[model samples]
Target: MLAAGRGYMEERETGKQEAVASVREIFGLSGPLYLTAVDWENSHHRRSVAASLVQGVYILERDRQQKRQGHQSHASPWWNFFHFQLISPLIDDVDFSIFGAIYEYNSSVFEHNAPKYVIAFRGTLNKPDSRLRDLKLDIQAIRSKLHQSSRFQLAMQAVQDLVAVVGTANIWLAGHSLGSAIALLSGKNMTKLNYPIETYLFNPPFFSLPIECISNPKVKHGIRIARSVVKAGIAVAVKGQHHSSQKDDSFFVLSDWVPYLFVNPADHICSEYIGYFEHRKKMKEVGATKIERLATQNSIGNMIFGVCVRDCEPLHLLPSAYLTINMSQTPDFKRAHGIHQWWDPSFDGQSELHLFR
Candidate 1:
């Protein structure tokens, strides 16, 4: 994995590439780690933010090692080849750094192309006033991560910025909680704008869309494309059970993604409070198709393309120190239920992604 992420950039770009490579090392997380980085704020200048649907991935066993894995591939060629073919281009697409992947054990290596632009976003729910902070975020000490940028915002920014740097561009949206929702939404926005988009939704929340796009073309377009995820059954989504008020937290599904992942129960409201200050009143959301309906639909696309990606419990959520969940029972998987957007092997290997960038 280090070799794949290290020195990935050109002669002059090595510094940035290495920085991304060392993310896990700097953070000191245990087990496999997945992270995203992006540059936003500039995207709206020529393009809207683009979420990196995918990012670097890793797996940890026993010793709980957080790094070092290139040696494992020596045992298998397919895994080696998978590593070379898939991972070599992670800067541009998915990287084969993790185990159990077709590319994880690839053999051949290709000449590198242009250096991939990195991005970062701020997904932590940080607010000045204690009253303004989301309880979930505060509990996670996300408020303390002042230096950490929002992966969701950064990924969208990266999508928009990469266009200026990369001749061709694609949006890869992946993340946990808010980051995941932002990535999915950002991809939808790109779809509407008619940009070259290949979205990678990871643990994306079946969140309620903001009311700002009620009449916007981008909003409408994103909704339509998002519906496609539903049709494909790739999205473990949730719809607002109560339509009366613009702000409702009721869920419509109990099965599918959220429950399967077994993320902290309080993850459900992480958005409600996180999006605070911006939409304190609990804004209205618009979706082409209800999240609940997508749950029941048995489409060939979902069954065939969609992989049941989650384990009964996420490796990160197993301990309370890392994540303390406040569970609330509800039918709506998206609302007040950390059920819809989740990571795991059930939906394929997207479980480890942190789309905040």
Candidate 2:
């Protein structure tokens, strides 16, 4: 198990180093990977729009190809230029895009470390409607074991195949935004399959579902009621499950490998969902359903008093960090949510003071 301090340091370095390589290898994207990761507008609006449209189509086609083949594409999009596969194709008929990056662990050189594998999932690039559809699919899968979508099914196959080939112990899972959620689900599924995995998640959304009602005054009442029900249900469902402790013999034990979660302070996915989940897990152990209810009620009350005052802070005690990505350049709150924001160069590279206990 990785200690909290060491894990945080290792995660930051791994992210910085891998972000450069993963961006270039996974996508045939050029220039800065962070720039393409977000829909940042340049002076030429037409070119940006056209490029985004083209990228959207490209991503969807890749998703389709992986599904049709029942695994990742046989010939990676990088193969013609690079003349090699980053990840080997595992299944003949699985779904979802699961790319493998071959690297040597101990060696600094790409070839020297010989055969270490880092499996990565790409984030969303499609239009909002398509993204939302995928989000719902993932949510349904998580909420119900019987309702496995192509993404869930294929992710399991991919991880299982890789674990068989590489052996389970040292394998790493990485992803951003939507991809982060996929990686998490895949890791959780892998755990149940008796394969422990190390995961690095960037800007993973809380529950990975859109909270449209959170901001809409007309829908606030309904949102609160829905949230209350969800709070109670999660409190009941996840009670007695220790999220950080690895000592459990049960299925949900996170003991096998440490997870490194990176997000901005304002990221709703990490702060809100992660916080809520952590709070509930603690309550479950103590059999404190009343406290859980009070916490949920208090959060709702705070939101009503002044929505902006309610900051969805991530679980400070978890191995989490605030990436100080400058947001002044882009005023859109939506853009601030991207993992790309954390990689910006303007801010000091280090994460804020450790909040985890």
Candidate 3:
């Protein structure tokens, strides 16, 4: 009995260690703005601030690696076709640490292709302060405060500046976890404003519509009307602009750029039931869906009491090409969720890179 007890304790310790390591890797990749002291009060203008933050000491290694990847002979064909440049910076506020990266590509080899940009967002940190910070963000997320979130706002500013300089329909976006949520919301909002860009959502959270949207019909209706108005305005403003040729897929042709969604079926945050029907269909197109309805049902029940109260169906979130990573041997919960698991270097070989961009 004593031996068994010792073994159990050891197992628990190992699990805790793994959890810590997983979270640490995410913060490390996000760089040191949240890890170190940040001068929030006297921060420079958004453009200069973003540029300076990308030069942070901690992020240098990743920048170096990205550059090295660009020079690799066996790099993706996509890389060979265009010249890629990157800028990453952590934008910190009182509530959240938002990590943003921009990749600029110029089709030097191909004329009339025009320059393009890819914006990436890093998920939440696992630090002590981040835990406290998440308390407020959790509430805000439940409220679906996309426009109100400082992190979301900062991301928009970066995109807006880039759009002005490089122009539209040439931008792509990517993010994981909380960052994914922000990216989806931002992409949706931007599309309504006629600045449609392709996006990649990596393990997006389950609560796409927010609990508040479910509870308050008026708020939901108001948001819908507002978006419709924005879309109408955009259509009028860009009426004479040249439209790009649609991609091959019927589902992808709905938007300007095809959004690619990378997820693990076992991921608690992004299982089969989490997103809309169109999203599930896209996931099916890429790979098999993992059924963990009991876990998902329980998770949803816990997150929003509003779901229980409301009889009507909640609104669907962004639609994209869903790519699921298969891990039959590992526990569904263990293999799924968490920012680091999906993109960590340790699992690079395991990642399904061929299917989606």
Predicted candidate 2 versus true structure: per-residue lDDT over 1-357, tens digit per residue? 001111111111254332112231234343123332222233122122222222222333344433434344322332222222343432213333332223213333354212255555545433222345454544453333312456546656777877888786656666555555666667765665677676666655553234432566447434544665665555343443523332442222433434556554345545454444444444555676564543442233223333221122111112223322232454444544554344333433323322322
Q: Write down the lDDT of every candidate, Cα atoms only.
A: 0.27, 0.41, 0.42
Once superposed on the true structure, which residue ranges of model 2 sit more than 4 Å away at CA? Answer: 1-85, 89-115, 127-147, 192-194, 208-252, 273-330, 347-357
Candidate 1, position 311, lDDT: 11
In model 3, the Cα lDDT at residue 101 comes to 64
Displacement of the residue 271 alpha carbon in candidate 2, Å: 3.0
- Best-to-worst ranking by lDDT: 3, 2, 1
TM-score of each prediction: 0.28, 0.48, 0.49
lDDT of 3 by residue, 1-357 (tens): 001001111111254333211222223332223212223232121111222222221122222322323433121221222244555554557643435667666544542323366676655433343445544554555545545767778888887787777766677666656666667766765665667766666666655433222346566445433433443444333323523233432223234434545555555456532333333334345453322111111223322333321122211233333344434343435335543343332342223222122
lDDT over C-alpha atoms for residue 12 of model 1? 24
Per-residue lDDT of 114 in model 3 = 33
lDDT, candidate 1, 1-357, per-residue tens: 001111211122254432122222221231112322112332211111111112222221100122234653112221121232333221112221121111211224431321233222212222122112223322322222211224223445556655555533422233334333444344443543445343332222322333322457466445545544554344333212212331221111111112112232323333222221122111113342344233222232323443221211111111001111223343343333321222211221111211110
lDDT of 1 at 3: 14
Cα lDDT of candidate 2 equals: 0.41
